[model samples]
Target: MAKLLFGSLAWFSFPSFADNKPLNSPVDYLSVLLSLVVVIALVFMLGYIMRRFNVTQQGGGQMKVVGSMALGTRERILVIQVGEEQHMLGVTAQNINHLAKLDSPLEVAQPSGDNFKDKLTQLMQGQKGKTHD
Candidate 1:
């Protein structure tokens, strides 16, 4: 009786083992591809929804980044305009320091006579001269 019971259990388990075949059908591959595409689209949709709702964004007010300059590898200078006032801030990897609050917002000067590359080269050269002096 024990042998008969074990045989019946083995017979049921055999079909389960046989069902574990590698995915060899085009339909199986298509289903996997479709699932991957769906997951990627869902992630993108979630990011878009969060951005639309300003979920991870800072300062929900009317403050805007007017300009930014990199001072060093880990340091930056930011000019932020809030209403009619502009605030200059020195931001490092360790801390954010308030540099100044301007009474009147500074206007961005338009470059003249040269392209961006020429202006950048001139600026770099000027920095080198200043360092040498």
Candidate 2:
């Protein structure tokens, strides 16, 4: 019985040993290093190009109209003033049809005020009165 048990255990251990060898080789390590270097070089090249061209100039200079009311209720058109110039943008289906088509960055500054909740409550009460009819 002891011999049979020993033989079975040895047979199961041989298959496991065959599969336990490491899968990666020296060439795999070299390939990974080469890829990392290539990616780093590409990123540096992109940074150099951006710095040389001055892409940041688009946001600061003279006023340019960059937004318009295209497709929304309440005539919600975005009007932006840059430096001195002003532009009237027609945000309609005839235009880019979406805000994403605008070329300039539009940021919404936070309003600094208290009593916003009171104003909201009043507006909600007014709306409730209208709906009751």
Candidate 3:
């Protein structure tokens, strides 16, 4: 009886040892790394193609920001023109509130690229920020 039990236990132990042998090889690890790189590259390529083609960008004519003011670091007020009508909006980090409907639209700044760069530099140098009337 003791011999039979010992034989059965030895048989089970051999199978468990075989199972513990590392199933993963260097080739399997390399294959997984290559697959991850391929997926990341495909995502970046798709993003570039979308930007280059300007996919899903609507032509601007329906609405535009007339003007804006910074009340605080995280708060702002903007006048937005929607078609023929204009609206005043109070903006915060969490929500936007309609403040009023303006009787007259605010004068919007139409700065050229170079002019805007210069203005930004001047503002950064601690000059009094120009207010658009």
Candidate 4:
């Protein structure tokens, strides 16, 4: 009787005791792949929305990023134009600090103010021009 009770409990605990087949279903794989694609698409959509509306940038009426340079992964220097005045600011993940107010606003070749992207575009254009020349 004890052995019967133990075997019954074991059968309930161990699924393999009732069914020897493994859980290798095609539907399961398809479901996982669909879920992954949906999640990736959602991330991209959110990013586009944020950039499109400037959702992360508050009080963007007068302030414009004239220039920006990354000091580290999360720290950077930004030159922002407020009306006729341009102010240089030090920005980090934590807070923003006023560095100085520029008498003359720096010339920006690209209005986006991402220095790396602007520089890359310049380098690519230079190389393309050289190839053509």
**Which candidate number maximizes lDDT?**
1
Q: Each prediction's TM-score against the native?
A: 0.37, 0.29, 0.40, 0.45
Backbone clashes (count) for model 1: 0
Better of 1 and 2 by lDDT: 1
Error of 3 at 17 (Å): 36
lDDT of 1 by residue, 91-116 (tens): 99999999999877888545573755
Candidate 4 per-residue lDDT over residues 1-133, each given as its tens digit? 9879867766344343346456477765675577679879999999998766546533548777877788998889999888889899999999999999997678755556455556898888888877532
Residue clash pairs of candidate 2 = 63-83, 69-91, 70-91, 70-92
Winner on lDDT between 3 and 4 is 4
For TM-score, the strongest prediction is 4
Instruction: List per-prediction Cα lDDT, in the order shown.
Output: 0.76, 0.55, 0.74, 0.75
- Which candidate, 2 or 3, has the higher TM-score? 3
Evaluate model 4: give its TM-score.
0.45
Ranking by TM-score: 4, 3, 1, 2
Better of 2 and 4 by TM-score: 4
lDDT of 2 by residue, 15-97 (tens): 33336655377665665577679879999999998756534443445554454444464344656555533334445445532
**Poorest 10 consecutive residues of model 1 by lDDT?**
9-18
